[model samples]
Structures are given as structure tokens and as C-alpha cells.
Target: MDLAERIESLKAGLLGAIAVGITFTFTVFIHQTLTVSNNWVLPAFPSSFEDLSAWVREAVAFGSGFLFGVTYRYIIRQGENPHLKSGAVMAFGLVRGLAQIESISDRFTSQPWLAFVLLGESAIVFAVAAASIDLAIAWRWIKPAS
Candidate 1:
């Protein structure tokens, strides 16, 4: 690709990353609120912000968003309009499917309901984040892929 094209790709990727990161973080906050309010089952999250696991989870979440953003950018570059819907379907489908494995595993045998709730929450978060990121790009709030 030419220099301008390369620069445009980089800008698009960065925009996607920022959009996804913010959206995912917001969705996760919503999920946490719901979890606390409903007393839902959750993995043993660190109780303290200073805990290693807490930071690790934060990093993982952001990393996941960044990856998703990059992927979404590529998808949009393929001439997909209604990009938000396409990205949401792809993102949520993959996340929900992967999340189901834990919910169906023998590990959650004693509390299948917990697994169900967790899976539902995951679906909601992924869908919201995906839609938010794509919409931002579509609306030019985020730079489009060249």
C-alpha cells in the first residue's frame, strides 16, 4: 500500500481501538452494576483495585477490545455497510459461543443458574460494545478505514 493508505489504516485502527475500548469499558461497568444488584454469580474477582488480578483483568479486557477493533476495521474495509450490525453479529456470536463453554462445563454443575446468568451478561456486554464501536465508525465519530 502507499504511504497515505498505510497512514489511513493506522488512523482507522487507532480510532477503532479507542472506540472499542471505551465502549467495552462502559458495558462492563453496566454488567458489574447488574451483577451487584442482582447478586449474580461471578468468578472470584479481586476485591481490591490494587490487586494483581484486578489489573490483569483490566488489561485483558482492553486487549480484547483492541483486537476486536482491529478486526472490525478490516471487516469494514471489505465494503460492508450496515457495518454496525455485521460487527455486532460477528463479535457477539463469537463471544457468546465461547462464553457458553464455561457455563456448560462440569465446573458449574452445582450452580448452573449462575453460569446461565453469566452467559447472558456476556452476551449483553459484547453486543453493546460491538454496536457502539461500529456505530462510532459509521457516524464518523471514529475515522473510517480507507
Candidate 2:
């Protein structure tokens, strides 16, 4: 890719990541509230939201969205329609890949239900992010991959 194309890709990725991060934050907030209020689902958070450690973790999670955006752009060739099927497929692959990691597997061994919920949430968030990015590209709000 040319320098200009690379720059545009970076811009798109950043914008997409910001959009996804905002959406993810809201989703997590709502999920947490409902889970806590209902007492039916117990999510295994590493720390309390108010804790600095939690903030650090959240930052990392948000940053990962940028990588996801970049990857999505790379996967969908230029001029190709970034349709729902592509987005869903990418999200599923990402979620499944992460779930296969030993660290993730070990972390959820004691709380398989929480793992399932988290995995589902991750898939939904990624799928939405992917679709939103594609919409932005289609609308000319962001530059498409080249």
C-alpha cells in the first residue's frame, strides 16, 4: 500500500475503534447493571470498576478494538461489500480463537457460565463493530481499504 493509503487505513481503523469502544462501554455498563440487579449471572471481573486495575484492563480491551478494526479492513478487500455475513464470520472466528487460548480457558475453568456469557458478548460487540465500520466506509464517512 502507498503511504496515503496506509494513512487512510489508520484513520479508518482509529475511527472504527473509537466507535466500537464507545458501544462496548455502554453494552458492558448495561450488562453489568442487569447482571448485578438480577443476581442470575455472575461475571468474573478481574477487579471492581472503580479500581485502577479495572481501568487498566478496560484500556487494554478498548485498544484491542483498533486491532480488530484494522484486521477487518485487511480481510475485506477493496471494492468488496463488507456485508453482515463477513462481519459475523470475522467476529465468530475472533471469539473462537480467543476462547481457544490456554490462558482464557484456565481463567474460566471455575466459572464456565460466565465464560460463555463473556464469549457471547465479545462476539456481539465485534460483529456490531465490524458492521458499523463497513457502514461508515459505504457512506464515505471513512476511507475504504485499498
**Top-TM-score candidate index:** 2
> In candidate 2, what are the lDDT values of residues 12-128, reduced to their tens digit?
568656765775577557767776788543343432367775576567556767777777766775456656446654565466436534345655677666655666566766777
Cα miss at 37, model 1 (Å)?
Answer: 6.5
lDDT of 1 by residue, 41-91 (tens): 355333334567666655655555556655666666656677654555466
TM-score of each: 0.61, 0.73
* Model 1 stretches with alpha carbons more than 4 Å out: 2-40, 44-50, 79-106
Error of 1 at 122 (Å): 3.0
What is candidate 2's local distance difference test score? 0.63
Task: At residue 146, give the lDDT of candidate 1.
Answer: 60
